[model samples]
Target: MRAAHIELTPTEDDRRIARYAAAAIALSVVEAAIPMPLPGVKPGLANIITLVVLARYGWRDAVWVSLLRVVAGSLLLGQFLAPGFFLSLAGALASLAALGLAMHLPARWFGPVSQSLVAAFAHIAGQLAVARLWLVPHDGLIAIVPFFALAALLFGLANGLAAAKLLEDAGRTRQ
Candidate 1:
């Protein structure tokens, strides 16, 4: 039996999504290098890309980029199929769900900053839930919620600001 030849064609939108996913993966790699004070408290730099993609493209494309980042980032970081990978996957799913709802809010009231804040919290909540139910299985795990929430708030705000600035610059350059 001969192997079948395969042809793949990528549209502009596909290329755009790939580029965004690659950028997010790059950010994840860089984030993994940074030493974190807490185990799960690294700055989510890739989320900035997710927020930008969500704003510019849509939730579908954002989902593609976010999920692609989680999978590819895990493979690159040697965490594929590990507990960390599942945690990351759970967080991405939660964040995407939140973004899906948030994107529907009035544009004047909720932009990238507000959306990012919401997604960040959802991301942490998903991770905590997974850790509690699957990894830790201990009631004491709830005690760390405050610390993670603070980190999520701070990092989400910073990432949101960065994304907003990028969007602003992109808008200017389009003129």
Candidate 2:
């Protein structure tokens, strides 16, 4: 029996996805290098790319870029098949889902700031839930929820502001 051969054609959309995913993965790697004083207090720099992609493209492309980042970042960081990978995947999925819903809100009222904030909170929620079900499996873990939420809020706000500025800059470049 011969193995089946398949060829895929790359389109402009595929190139766009590659560019966005590269940016996300690069941010993730850079963030990993930063020393965190606490366990769940990451600045979530990679998520800024997600917010920008979601705003510029749509949820579908945003989701693709997010998942690709988790997978590729894990492999690059040598965390593949580790607990960190699972946590990252869970958080990405949750955030993407949040972005899907957030995208429906009035774009005028809810821009990158709102979307980024929502995704950040949702990311923490997913990670906590995963920890509850898998890692610690302790009700006491809930005690740390407030801290993570606060971190998420701060980082999300920062990322959202950065994304907004990037979008603004890109708009200027296009003109």
Highest TM-score against the true fold, candidate: 1
- Local accuracy of candidate 2 as per-residue lDDT tens digits, 17-134: 9999999999999999999877856898999999889888988999999999999999999999898888899898999999999999998787899999999999999998898999
Q: Measure candidate 2: CA RMSD.
A: 1.8
TM-score of each: 0.97, 0.95
lDDT of 2: 0.92
Number of backbone collisions per candidate: 0, 0
Highest lDDT model number: 1
For candidate 1, what is the lDDT?
0.95
lDDT of 1 by residue, 51-132 (tens): 9999899999999999999999999999999999999999999999999999999998778999989999999999999999
Give the 10-residue window scoring lowest on summed lDDT in candidate 2.
Answer: 36-45
Give the distance in Å from residue 30's predicted Cα in candidate 1 to where it truly belongs: 0.4
RMSD of each: 1.3, 1.8
